[model samples]
Target: MTLATAAHAPEGGTTAPAVRIRDLTVVYKTPAGELPAVSEIDMDLPAGTITGLVGESGSGKSTLALSLLNAVQPPGRISSGTVEIDGLGDVVPLQGDKLRRVRGGQIGYVFQAAQNSLNPLKTVGKQLLDLGRSHDVDDLRALVSEAKELLGRMGLDGARVLDSYQHELSGGMRQRVGIMLALVLNAHVVVLDEPTTALDMITQANILEIIRNIHAERGLTTLVITHDIGVVAEVADQLAVMYGGRIVERGPVRSVLGEPRHPYTQGLIRAIPRLTGDIDQARALPGRPPTLGTIPERGCVFRDRCELRMSVCDTVEPVLERHADQLVACHAVAGQEPDGGAPTDDGQEQT
Candidate 1:
């Protein structure tokens, strides 16, 4: 299908964001100095909508996702910003049990690599029960039954899968189990970080289907952090493009994918391979993505690689500004395009 048509399109009417992050900056303390992995980000994941955070590796996508649940490990901390979940209030200051409660309950997490995240030695039922236990769900039988029901919903044979170990299932089944656990924990918002990684194309499609199905049935607010634009196009209602520790572009999935405004976003879309016409024409982006240690401290972070860079971009950092349907941070995009020069599919100025 097309990116414009999501099976579970976010319903209009909800004005409040399920998760609102304002000026979020995450810093990792290194021997070299403080490294900002996420810098001054302002974003909103609307209630009951699937918002995709897409970028190349080291673009702070995972860092932003972890920050949502306050799970950023030591050495990396939320240096500043407010993380407000719709019903939970501000999480920046929450600590101890309060913070623990928010995690896995209010906000569920599906880490990358299901094989690595699951305990290989533990039975599926045992693991699910342990997760439930953490959320004050102590009744073992009840937890197992609930887990089975959730697994069934995810297309697994509830009883058969529950009794088995992680190694017993195929890669696709394990991945779905990872998703099922997140839903079973009863989280209002689920953060899935690269859930489709290490899977074949068919398996990837299956996983995406599972995600859309679960979201539709549960009405859970979802944040899918991925590097694949194609995957985000298939599953997300809205798309946010992150680069060099900041959100460079964000809008409705169709709008951003159809007419990307940011130069980095343009590069990414240009790089996606088309199956039919001109399949070999896909171009690779030049240069590597900047890491926390390598990114410069001032001005525009993407200036080094942007082809549309202007002299003003060298000295002044471009704040994210509204342009049509999306928010973009780039001097080239912020300036007015001459009349009749519309944006192309890859966000280039079309004469």
Candidate 2:
């Protein structure tokens, strides 16, 4: 399937976005001083649409997700940025009870590795009760009913799954449980991190379908974080590419995938092995991604591995600029084609 034709919400159409992230920068207090794990990032999760944030490990995808709920732990803080939710204003300054209420109340999060995130010691039902109690749900029966309904909707016997411990359920079942917990609180905005990490190809496809169905059915705004580009192509209407903590590209999934401008984005797409394409055409990127400490203090963070790197890339960092239908951050691309030239057979943009 083409990236643009995923079963997702209509493109460029959203009713008062559910979440708006602006100038978001999360930093970790390391011996080398405050190193950024997520740099000046800006994104929007349109009301009732799915926006996928794709990148390799250590690309700050998870850090950006945590900033949504302002849940970045100590030593790591949302140094600068504003995360504005629909009902809640800028969440950057919210604290204590107010912040707690927003998390899981208005926004639900399905963390990476749903199975590991669950409590092995407690049965699913017991944990669900704990969640309700923490939120001060007055009617325990009503809450349980909602949980059961959600689980049943996902095609599982709610009662049995709830009675089972974390170890008792399979990986896919645990993932569905995670989704149930996130929605059981009636959250309108959901953040799913690596929703299909360890699952086989078949299970991954199943989970993606469930996500699409539930998102459309509930009219929810969703942000899906994954390292896999295929996952984004499967369910996201809009796509954002992150590298070295910065968002280098973003736009409608179809436009961005059809003609990627950024070298990093092109390289990533080129690396994916296609069933019909020549196997030898698929190739890996030249160098490894930069680590936190190794990230350049100045200049482009991706220049070290970029084949199209220029002298300016070593001195000035590229800023996000509109290129045709997508936004790209690359000196090479910006200098070459104003329209972000189409991709060639090799996947690199035709100069």
Candidate 3:
């Protein structure tokens, strides 16, 4: 899909947006001081498409996802920015009962490691009922019926699965249960964090297919967070690459994957193992991702690992600038022409 098609609206005409995030920063308190986990970030999840946030473990993908529900916990807080849902204005200031209602009512979250997120003490049905009660669903029988239907759609025996405990289900089954719970409330916006983390390749493929099918069937706005670029490439219409708390690159999934502009994105794509490429061509990124305390206070966050590091990178951080269809934050690519030629000092495109 083109950038305009993927971002502004899906195949159909313009629709109300599902979520808009702007200047969002989340920070955790440390002995040293407050450190950012997510920096000034801006993102849009169009009403009926999936937007993927790809990054390493410490890249704040989860934090950004949590901010959507205003669920950031203690020590860590949404220090700044706005999370505006279509129905709910800015969720940054929502608190107490209001915040609780918004979460799972309008927005559903399938957390990372679905197996662990479940309460082992309670059966799935009991937990589902508790969720209904918490949300003050008047027709609980109807709620239960809806849950059963959703589970059935996911290829599970709804009655038996609901009666069984978490341990009774396989990894893939638990993941489906999680998805069912998230959607049973009839939420319009959904967030799935590492939805297929520990599954086998076959199971991962199955889960991804289910996600894509359910998302389209429901016409839901979805945000999928994953470390695997392949996952995003498979299921996401729009892709955003995050590193060191900032989005380094974003664009239509096909455009970004076909021709990655940011150095970090290029390295990530190069690192992926391919089915037909020469084995030696697959290389891993050098060095480890930065910890919260170790992130640079200024300048480019990826410069330490970037091959095209320049003097300008050491002092000035490159803001996300449009380069054709992609928005890239890298000094090396900042002034490049749409056709990919860098401008020379004399204002001519370098050959």
- Model 2 pairs whose backbones collide: 4-254
Query: Taking the tens digit of each residue's C-alpha lDDT, what string does model 2 give over 85-140?
Result: 88789999999999998899888999775448788999999999999999999998
Q: What TM-score fits each model? A: 0.90, 0.91, 0.93
**Ten-residue stretch with the least lDDT total in model 2:** 342-351
Model 1 lDDT on a 0 to 1 scale: 0.82
**Model 3, residue 55: C-alpha shift (Å):** 0.6
Off by more than 4 A, model 1: 1-17, 337-351
| Candidate 1 residue lDDT tens string, 1-351 | 112223434454143237878889999999988999999888877777889999889899999999998878889999999898988998989999989988887888987754467888998888888887788886778878877887787778989988889889888888878887877867879999998988899999988998988886777789999988888999998899999999999888998999998999999999989888897688888888898788887789998888997888878888776677677888787676533233443342211
List ranges where model 2 is wrong by over 4 Å: 1-17, 339-351
Instruction: Give lDDT per model, in order.
Output: 0.82, 0.86, 0.86
How large is the C-alpha RMSD of every model relative to the true structure?
5.4, 5.4, 4.5
2 or 3, greater by TM-score: 3
- Ranking, TM-score, top scorer first: 3, 2, 1
Top candidate on TM-score is 3
Indicate the residue-level lDDT of 313 in model 3.
89
Between candidates 1 and 3, name the one with more favorable lDDT.
3
Report clash pairs, candidate 3: none
List the lowest-lDDT window of 10 residues for candidate 3.
342-351
